[model samples]
Target chain A: MPFFKITLIRSSIGLPKKTQGVLNALGLRKRMATVFKPVNPSTAGQIMKIKELVAVSEVEAAMTSAEMKALRKPDPGYYIETPGLG
Target chain B: MFGPFRATSPLSGGLLWKIPWRLSSPQKRRQRKRLRLVDNVVATVDAALKRQNMESGRNLVRWKEEMPTEEEMRPKDKYTMFDRKEKKYRKGIHKLPKWTRVSQRINPPGF
Candidate 1:
């Protein structure tokens, strides 16, 4: 399924409770936070409610949590060629 | 001659909150920019849906087709909103609560 990659580019502080609730429902907890949601009627409606506070784009597939964590994981200075157990 | 300026609230009979009657030039510029961004997002979604042949994103297609282009918008609509009070039935954007956080693009027809 195509996913809508939403990023909370702007803060929701002091906005209406409804708007804030939409952001919360979208899983955008803070500024610069990003969440991928399947593109559908409900998600589109949510995006419309908080369009001013977010940036949205479409992607082919949602990234898994492991893949996202790997992207953020740093490369250590050294890598072991042989395992201790092996 | 003007005395030394002291920016202080009055002892009594002053409003605790004040909203500007008009949007400043910079504020107007930013507002226009935001509207443009929203338009861009809609267009992007429409294109993405078309590419994937997704029929569920109907709003994106209908919205893009109905909303006026930035160039086609009236100057009044571009910069201000409809208000029952004030001259011309329009007022400064800042007067609206959470003006920056909400979309105020659409106004009453013939307003």
Candidate 2:
């Protein structure tokens, strides 16, 4: 399934109320907030509404909410070595 | 004469003092080189292990902790009690306006 990676680069402030509503509905309330939605007609239409404020890219597969959250998290650098890995 | 005998005495300190220092000089340099090599090896191994752990979806930077099986681990415990307490008590959940820096360090020995 195709996925769309959408990042709100521009702020919704000072934009039209309807445009701001679109951003809020998309879960992009802050600048640089990223949301991933499946590539469907409804999502495509929503992207079109705020195309100027967001950067969108279509990817091969959509990540789950947990996976997206993990992606945004920084990696902790150390790991305990199992007896065999050591 | 007694003066000539004193001047040529074998107990003169100069030769013996310089001999020990000169003998150990080369050995000390070699020992330092060996220590440097060992340190580099350790650093390289650490880097490789860190990369491998990250690729396997584990964080290696934290202190050595017990590796919990997927079934045994409590995911909810990952969030601290303080965070949950704050959420329960706070009336409104507002986003932080900007980044803030907080220092958290435990004093080690002689620190």
Candidate 3:
């Protein structure tokens, strides 16, 4: 199923309490926070409420938080080689 | 003072310790080869680290460029107030109607 990748791009500091609650329900605690939800009417409505504060994209698969972190991490390019003991 | 000439001790006066004879040619060659291999590994690791650093540095610069600035990141309603009691002009963002329909969802077209 397609997923909506919702990223909180702006703060909700002065927005209405209802809007803040919607953001909380969407699991967006701070700016740049990302959450994935199945593409559905309810999720779409929530995104619409905070459309000005977030960036949304459709993704094929929903990634876990750990996977997202790993994607952002830099690769370690080298491996150690050990001598064989005879 | 002297027992049978102890091969273990280089201090024994009668027999001189020969440097070249002790480690045979094959063992010396193997040690030299191992040292060269170690040097090559070190060079490879150094090069890899340099490349990684350069890539990371470029990524950092790009990230800075791509990230939204402070002005752009501020909440849309930051300058506006919800209350009408104040005399000053307040641009209320939440005063707008809540979106209930999926068709009302607004996002960048290409994102």
Candidate 4:
């Protein structure tokens, strides 16, 4: 199933209470917070309500929290060539 | 000056004095070689097994999909409560004139 990747890009400080509630329901509390939800009419309507404060993208699958953290980590450049004598 | 002087003179003569104190020439120290395990076959096999394990481990991680373009996700237009011409800004959206009116939307044109 396809998923919607919703990211809060702008602050909802001065927006209406209804808009803020939509953001809270979408699991977006602070700026740059991202959440994944299945593509459906309800989610689409919610995104339309606060379209000005978020960026939305359609993705194939959702990544777990651990996977996201591992993706962000940098790779170690060198590998062990020879084992030392124990 | 006759007997004792002649006997000691031969002891310090040219042939005997020309010889060196030591006989053999000094030998150079040899460089030490690094230690290597005797089992060459086992080491090469172990290295090959480790490389295969690493290649299989890389396949376990799934690839992520690409994100949408910026133009697709961008807001329609930039709207702010601050009016540059009047030098006044509204504290909240509820304070705006069109907050309660359904006919007049808060968003500007082309939004």
lDDT by residue for model 3 over B24-76, one digit each (tens)? 45653543443333333223323333443422233223423553332343333
lDDT by residue (tens digit), candidate 1, B14-84: 77556567788999888788878887776666666566666644555556666775666777777788888
Better of 1 and 3 by lDDT: 1
State the displacement of the C-alpha of residue A77, model 3, in Å, after optimal TM-score superposition: 3.0
Ranking by TM-score: 1, 3, 4, 2
Residues A5-83 of candidate 2: C-alpha lDDT, one tens digit per residue? 7887767666678888889889998988878776555565566566556766656776776997898899798888778
**How far is each candidate from the true structure, as Cα RMSD in Å?**
4.3, 29.8, 30.6, 36.5
Q: Which stretches of candidate 4 lie over 4 Å from their true place?
A: A80-86, B1-111
TM-scores, all models, native as reference: 0.75, 0.38, 0.43, 0.43
lDDT of each: 0.77, 0.48, 0.54, 0.48
lDDT of 4: 0.48
Q: Over the stretch A1-86, how does candidate 3's per-residue lDDT look in tens digits?
A: 66778888768887689989999999999999999887655565566566556766667799999999999988789888899897
True contacts kept of each: 0.40, 0.00, 0.00, 0.00
Over the stretch A50-82, how does candidate 4's per-residue lDDT look in tens digits?
655666666679877688779988998888789
Question: lDDT by residue for model 2 over B28-97, one digit each (tens)?
Answer: 3443343333333223323433443422112222211432322333422211111233444321111112
The numbered model that scores best in lDDT is 1
Residue A25: error of model 1 in Å? 2.0
Model 3 misplacement above 4 A: A82-86, B1-111
Which runs of model 1 end up more than 4 angstroms from their true locations?
A64-86, B1-12, B16-20, B56-62
lDDT of each residue in B4-43, candidate 4, tens digit only: 6565635666554443322222210100000011112122
